[model samples]
Target: MQPNEIAEVLNRPLSQELLARDLTRLAYVATDGTPRTVPIAFVWNGTEIVMCTTTNAPKLPALRHNPAVALTIDTEVHPPKILLIRGRAELDLVQGIPDEYLQMNGSYEMTPEQRVVWEAEVRSLYDSMVRIVVTPTWAKLIDFETTLPSAVEELVKQRAERQGA
Candidate 1:
């Protein structure tokens, strides 16, 4: 999709709401030529989707080999609202904790004391991290209201034709 078209899809109010969600299913091609999808915490920074991982993460090698990836963020309710994004992952190694990591995981329900301890544990566990940044090249939002899966949309059109016949 064109950059402006992707931006237009992502700029919708429903898309913005989906972007605020904390977890996204990241899909990528593993080194073994198989597909892999994992649920990971992420933060959407208006223009990009940022996910942090350990320096020695297993997915790192696969991503290094093939940066192309897809992400899905959606609601769990019936007639789910979904935001789909495709992009190339750019890995940036950073020293110390990244603020984005903290912000991404902050949505979890936690007491102040729990939060402090969690931060301490995280700080002790990792000296550095890799930030996987993806600036979307394509995007789609499916609310089942204003938009829908392509197959479903086709089915709706076929039904309309049949009814009109």
Candidate 2:
């Protein structure tokens, strides 16, 4: 899809809400030529999705070999609101822990003092991290009310045709 079209989907209210969510299931190709999908934390800056992980993270190697990725973010409620995104991952090795890492974990409940201690531990442990950035090449929002899956839409059309006959 064109950049403008992707942006249009991303700007929808449901998309915006999904972007605010902390968890996203990232799908990528593993070295063995198999598919891999894992739940991870992410921060969506208006333009791109940022995911931070340890430099030695297993997924980092896989991502480096295959930068192409797909992300799914959705609500758990019935007739779930889902945001599907396809993008290429850009891996950046940043010195020290990235601020985005802390920001992405901000929603997790923790006392102020606990946060301080956690930050200290993190600062001391990781000297560098990999920031996985993805710029959306395509995006779609499925809220079930206004939009239905491709299969469902086809079924609806078939049903309507039979009913009319």
Candidate 3:
């Protein structure tokens, strides 16, 4: 997909809301050639989705082997709004905690007192971090109210034909 196409889907109001969401399910090919999906916190910086993880994380090896990835950000309402993104992962190893790490984790709810403890724990745990940067190559927004997945759209047509047959 062209850059304009990616922007067109993600720039919509519903897509923007989903992009602001705290958790996105990331799917990628594992090092063992298996598919893996995990819920992770991410921050959208207008153009890219940034996530942080430990330098020695198991997922890092898989990501290094296969950069292609998919992300799903959605709401849990009756008629959910979903934003689907396909991208390539760019790994950056940083000496100190990256800003994206803090930003992505900011959505976790915590009392002021608890937050202080949490921050302290985070500070003590890891001396280095890795930033996973994803630049969307393709995108789809499905509101159910307004749109549907491309494959589903095709499936609906097929069903109609079968019914007529």
Best candidate, lDDT-wise? 1
> Model 1, residue 65: displacement in angstroms?
0.4
What is candidate 2's CA lDDT for residue 11? Answer: 95
Q: Where in model 3 is the C-alpha error above 4 Å?
A: 155-165
Give the lowest summed-lDDT range of ten residues in model 3. 96-105
TM-score of each model, paired residue for residue:
0.97, 0.96, 0.92
Model 1: residue 40 alpha-carbon error in angstroms: 0.5
RMSD of candidate 2 to true structure, Å: 1.2
Can you tell me which runs of candidate 2 are displaced by over 4 Å? none
Worst 10 residues of 1 by lDDT: 139-148
| Candidate 3 lDDT (Cα, 0 to 1) | 0.91
Relative to the true structure, candidate 2 reaches a TM of 0.96
Model 2 worst lDDT window (10 residues):
55-64
- Model 2's alpha-carbon lDDT is 0.93
lDDT of 2 by residue, 1-165 (tens): 999999999999889999999999999999888999999999998999999998888888888899999999999999899999999999999999998899998878999999999999999999999999999998988899999878899999999999995
Regions of candidate 1 where Cα sits further than 4 Å from its true position: none
- The per-residue C-alpha lDDT of model 1 at residue 2 equals 98
In order, candidate lDDTs are: 0.96, 0.93, 0.91
True-vs-predicted CA distance for residue 45, candidate 3, Å? 0.6
For candidate 3, report its TM-score.
Answer: 0.92
